[model samples]
Target: MSAQAQMRAGQGASAQAEGKAASKANPIVSALHQMAVSVLSEQLREMFEKADDILFDSAEKARASDEQRLYLDTMRIVRVQRNKIVQAFQEALQAALAGIGEDEAENAAGRLDDMSQWSLEDGDVLEERIAVNNMQAKASSLYAHELVELQRRIARLAEMTGAGLSPESMSPQRIIHAFQNSMRDLPVDFPIKLVIYKLFDRVVVGRLSEVFVGANQLLAVHGIEPSLDAPTPARPESRRAPRGLPQDSGVPSWAGKLDRATMGAFGAPATGGAGMSAMGAGAVPGGLAARQAGHLAPVGGAGTYTDSMLAQDVAQILGSYEHGRRPQAPAWLPPENVALVARMFDAYYRDPRLPDNLKPVLARLQLPMLKAAVADPRFFHDPNHAARRTLNDLFEMLLQFGSAEAAPSPQMVGELQGLIDAMVQAFNLDPATLRESARPEGVDERTAEAFLREQEEMQQKKNRARVERVRRIVAHEIRRRIGERPLPSGVLRLMLSGFGPLLCLDYIRSGVNGASWTETMRLVDRVLDSLRPDAGRHAEERAAEEAELVAAISRRLAAIGFSEERLKEVLSGLLQAYLELVEAGAGRTGAPAADTVDEAATAAAPLPPEKELQGLLSILLVPGSWFTLWEPVAQTKHWVRVKGYYPVQNTVMFGHYMEERFLQLRATALATALVDGSAAPIDPSPELQSAIARIGELSFERVVDPVVWTTVEGRPGQ
Candidate 1:
């Protein structure tokens, strides 16, 4: 038998032995083993029953002879070796479960050794492993909530039973690993294996929720945290403390001062006044507003008339505006506080930057926000206050719909409207409702921040797939073009490692048949040809040809924002390879020492100022940074927020601010945009901050317009 075959057989034998030993040594492992056998046996039986039919259908529909043959062979192997495969899989699972809490470093070292072997003899094995990892990542994301709950329940069960079981034993990574290990000895090709893995993912991993439910039930029967509820998603940690406050303050700098001001403003007793009925204060029992009137009643008040009266008046006035009536602030209420909220909404309504469709949705929040501001002074003082954060999150979510040139989908508009309606209905005197509305616990459907996060995750997934596709295309193209062409090893390495990404970017931006792609391919061929022997050519002719080729290469690299220093290094390497080829043609050994070649290739080169600037901008333009991009042809500016950068594609993804469009710019394109004044970064402060600043610019005495007071008091504006 071959050495590789013998090694794999020994590994399989060792795993089976470990599984048997663990079953004998640990009672917990025995229990888990029993459960896994019963559950997985039934699941695998169902899976295999359908697998043959699936393969037959695929073979019938196959477009190529090779594809049809592959399916037929896979089906035949599965039919013949069904029982053995199942037993092997069960054993692998048992071993994996038993090996929980084992040294991770040991497993990592084992994997490294396996990879080294695969590199030397079987690259298909490495590719299969990569495919499994990608499948596992996708499954983990799709069932994230279920997996988290399962981990929690398993941890609790372990704690109660005095078992050393780890939550990771049931992770997608481990589950996929066991299946891959079982199939390692099968005589199936990579494509067939991938198809089977997909089926396994669908049948086993997709139904992991059922397994989790059963495990939770088992734990509950043992009285381990009985009646376990769905786990709450943990809130992301705050990146920074409330703006303008000390990190360790625990309270805003204006908290105490605001408290004193609030008390003084609402401390006065009720005196029956002419505007009381207009403000809805007369609707209260005994014509005296209580602090606990309803959800809209301001909290933390001493039942004073001014406190509840002010909130009720704001709600009544804003409610009138909904019915096409101009809102008039109550004449007896504190003008400064009323004017602050009024001007804030007015600014929001008038702001041309906000899309027209979103204005009505935002307008619904005026009364809720006013009540929150009255009840909690932190709403104004702390930028990170829940209410302010919630508002900002909503605005950001709406803004991701591209620029005004592209319209948002009706479905997205409906979702936004629904969220606004829900928030308006739930909000009261407390701002916690705003936070809750943004990130609801125990809810099936995500609304504000959670919904946005899911969308961003999906976008990132698509971007990653695009990058992978582009890389595969680039690799195939390079191999096809370099078929059997003997070139210097250093030059080949430079083409693969250094210039490959630039080709990928060109393909991503302008597809396979584009002029840019053709030019890049031609340049690659020229570089390869420059290192070949030209027996009939004069020395000067060869030198001139090499010089022009180097210049062309430099220009191509420089256009992609490569630093001059890096460009010089690359050109020098190519020239050295050319000289070596010439020496070899003269019957002299020409290969440089390995160390010398390594230094020339691997040494870091300093970036030129422009390239350094590009790197700096790439780092700073993280997700959520806003920029205005100028369209020269349209003579218009587009507002976009950075979604992310994909290094493999050399692309930056930007989501438009007013519509549902996304734009991806290559690194060179982005750097050009910045340098040519076509793209400029902008500070998009939170909606509340801009309003507060606008209000600050107004004179304190005339904060409320004289005309508004006159109209509310039943007089002409004059």
Candidate 2:
């Protein structure tokens, strides 16, 4: 062969070798790359097909000639360019995957430059840029849960493979960029492009859960941990010095017998004949194995591990807390039980969720709880134990009435103080007194339950009345605004059926003078003005104004709980109405028919069964369910109780036990908060039960490395 031919062959051989090496280096990345390309290609094809149907359906339903023509033209262009779009998207996705580990700074800079270029370009480019951002935000909110799970799995894979990967590597931005880039050369206007983008969002982004699942499964097959365990902070070093039993302590003969029985129960060989010497010399095994052997069984069928012989010991510890003194765990208590209680309370004290004022209140319970745990063998093992139940109820009540940012009301402070004081005073050897003091006003369980139910019903009635008042205010404002200027029938319907409820939400959240109310009122004026023809303005300027009005109105209507599909329909009708008024060269001909305004106000179109059911489900806030309320301004979470659901306004009213005013959230906004992790439902299980489980987990960790607890003796209030 000639030298030139040999050079060409060598170059080809080098490229093939590099490909093999790259594939061998990270099989996981290669698998993921292939998976993404295949899924996106199929999704793109399906998205176009769905877009065709959506456009056809929209065109058929369009009320005005102009609106129908726009849909038909967009559909035709999409159909003709479908193959090229899919191929472009496939190439873009492949390129994005290949660039996963590249420097993110350069990519971000490149994006910034591109955005600058778009701003300097014509109006269409700017419109496309805004559309992309809006689509990304909507998709992210819609698929937040799936995206989070996918991100966790990807991170695990990256950790195992020593590869750099992130959620951004496979974000919807890539899909959107690729699709937008493909359409950059198309002849469609911004409105048509926007319709296509929405369809793409609905079809492609909606099916992202499948793509995420596929990627997760592939990573799982590659030995990556599929389940993500939340990272726990390292246990802090103990501050308290370890205390051992005193050698010269007074000890009765019966105590010696009890010590021997306890050691025997733990499988420790009792030696030196039942005395302090036997207890000190015989090392008690401290773990699950020792517990399984019934180490805490009552000595000689007595009611508690420590008999009346240790009553004075328990009293000394309890009195320390009552008198504002530092308390220590009794030496007579088993080390394992002491360690468990200490660790549990330590965890509680360190928890950021617990309010500061309540910390001292909870601290007072430490000694009493430790005493109860020592007396009851089943304290840690049984979740339904009476003492555990009482503790759980008390902890929950404290959380309900307390706020990290807000001061507790005087009534709240008094009630909680009284309950804690009663429980501390009444708690003796028997745990029954703890249960009695946990009830309201020290009443019996049945009477307490009845009283609480009645209080809750009254709160619900108050919430409903408040919501009705807000609704009336909103309805009156909307009526007055529309009556100020003559509006087309369609505009009147949109105001009543779509915008009215959202105004109510705004008024409820922030009063009539608030920013949300002001912005919504501005949107209402824009909608009214857009329907009138502008004789002097250029066609392009008028079109741009109309586009802005539609986008603003779409966002406002979305706040009233319209689904994406329903929103498209509403916008279509709105656009058609605008076109008819413009074509007739009439501006504010007359007020809408009185019957039309009244009917629109009173009768909204019935929601589809599925939509109605979803709305209902979103408002199903069971009373007493605790939610972490996100205050964006304060950047803090406050515990709030689900007071009641008001179906008339589709709102959930949240109450702070210390605050008389309730915080009402529309169901849509609440659902969005939950999806974005701003609001999270706390575990409804008993707090004490959860703490015990954590203690068991900590114990297991200690068992694996016994030295972890060598210096950490149980210090009750430390």
lDDT against the true structure, each candidate: 0.52, 0.50
For this target, which candidate reaches the highest lDDT against the unseen true structure? 1
Q: Model 1 reaches what TM-score against the true structure?
A: 0.33
Per-residue CA lDDT of model 2 for 492-605, tens digit only, reads 667765677567656654567789889999887777556655567776788788888888877665534354565676566567665664544443465543322222232324
**Cα shift from native, residue 443, model 1 (Å):** 21
**Model 1 misplaced stretches (Cα beyond 4 Å):** 1-29, 100-121, 226-718
Q: Which 10 residues in a row give candidate 1 its minimum summed lDDT?
A: 255-264
TM-score for each prediction? 0.33, 0.31
Candidate 2 runs further than 4 Å off? 1-24, 100-121, 226-718
lDDT for position 666 in model 2 = 66
Residue lDDT tens for model 1, 387-458:
555555455454444222345446435545555654555455443333233321211222222433433233
lDDT (Cα) of model 2:
0.50
